[model samples]
Target: MKQARPLPQYLVQRFQGWRATTFGENRSWYRRLAEGGQHPRAMVIACCDSRVHVTSIFGADTGEFFIHRNIANLVPPYMPDGQQHGTSAAVEYAVNALKVAHLVVVGHTNCGGVAGCHAMCSGHAPELEEKTSFVGRWMDILRPGYERVKDLPAENQIGELERQAVLISLENLMTFPFVRANVEAGNLSLHGVVHDIAEGTLKEFDPVSEGFSLVG
Candidate 1:
């Protein structure tokens, strides 16, 4: 039998330090959380980018927010097919089961997945078009978003496309019956946000203005 590789020494040391410090100081809180189960009020869908820190940005505690991260923070339109759908399933659980009050889709600048989608759609990355390319297949969900911003100059398209990811996800989230029902019933709200990674700034979508506004 093949043995599983052990975790890296650095990670082990970090975990030990956390266990001794942060975990130790909050032991009772952790215990209470374990016993009570999670009751997060908000559900955040964010990019897999390491720079996008959802909990830190909101100053959220351990059990305050239910977070789900995926490539480009894209939420595909609801498809009730028998096949597996990780993002949709999470949304269903968050809205139907957890009853989160708010659903936020957070996109970020300089997203590699968005850039790859831009490349693939523009015919610059022919390799991604192959059926065997998982990234390409997954990114195809963002094709419509790309089309919406294709007219922009090459230099500006990426940033616009990044914001489009959040917008698209927000739009797609409504396609889920559970999400729409909760939202229309005033039990849930949907939000779209874009983070400028390098500048450490955020822009929130304004449904009234139909555009994103800087958060002061």
Candidate 2:
């Protein structure tokens, strides 16, 4: 018979290995960061995908971005009512407490959530209703995105779907009063980014250029 290994043992092994490598080289940097508290220049709202790591994708350091992760990286519309809004709470802390200079909504290609939305909107994947629950409400933020790219050609689906979602999220970010106030004051900037994990590339939405471009 095979023996069962405890989950805690595997976790300890991973932690110890990480400490030996990452902590060994930059002990002082991490130590200072822990002491100084989180003072990131930006706050990145990204998906909680194992493959889509925010810091790794941005080539950022430990304290560079105050990251908040959720399914599909959805940003709920700001509401005064007492709802269980974890994503909104994180955004509030990032904008109100951390006062980050930039707020970036990072979407990606081949996103299961976005793909599911495409299915739900198109009436092709009715199983979404029976199998998934939260995605219905969470993906409401991307309704405008669906409307924007609903009629695009099949070849352009990959590019347009992800692009439209990022644009919509960027617009939604402004709907938050704190985001709007800070942006109007010229103290805060908003950005939309899409990570193409398959191609190992990133596309950034350039406001000045008014289009998505490859990021070096």
Candidate 3:
């Protein structure tokens, strides 16, 4: 019979440290969150990159935001064909059930997923083009974004592609009927942003100007 392995020593130590410090100090807060359930004010759809710390960036307390992390932070156009859709399910729950007022799609610089999509589009990453490659299929969601940036010089494409991913996701988010209903009703707001990981800065997208403005 197969068996599962225990967590590594470092992770165990880290968990113990958190329990003794962060959790210890906020025991009541944690209990209240557990009891009251999560009623977050916003929903953040961000990249799965480890450096993208959603809660820390916003200085959010526990249960303050419903976060969904995915490769390249891409959300496919709504297709209710009944196949498994992790990202769609998260958005649906956050919008319909949680009724979050704000939905933020965050992209970032030097994203590996964006790089992979670029490579595949340029025919440099053939392995990613295989039909059976899950990452390839997921990255396909960014093809429209790729088409917009493919002609840019090599050094510039990645950065622009990353931003494109955010815009693409924001556009895709509207395809969901529930999200659209809430947005049209003025009950939900959709925002797009790109983070420069090294500089610790954010560029917010403006629908009127169709450009990204650096946030002070």
Judging by lDDT against the true structure, name the best candidate: 3
Evaluate model 2: give its TM-score.
0.88
Candidate 3, 70: how far from true, in Å?
0.7
Model 1, which residues run further than 4 Å from truth? 1-3
Tens digits of lDDT, candidate 2, 1-216: 479765788899999999999999899998898898989999999987778988987789888999998777777667869878888888889999999999998888788888887887777767665545677767767777788787888677646776777787677778899989999999899988889888988889998998989989
| Residue pairs with backbone atoms closer than 3 Å in model 3 (clashes) | none
True lDDT of residue 85, candidate 2 = 85
In candidate 3 the C-alpha lDDT for residue 161 amounts to 91
Question: Residue 146: error of model 2 in Å?
Answer: 0.9
**Lowest lDDT 10-residue stretch of candidate 3:** 1-10
Best-fitting candidate, scored by TM-score: 1
Off by over 4 Å in 2: 1-8, 130-132
In terms of TM-score, how similar is model 1 to the real structure? 0.97
What 10-residue stretch in candidate 2 is worst by lDDT? Answer: 124-133
lDDT of prediction 2: 0.83
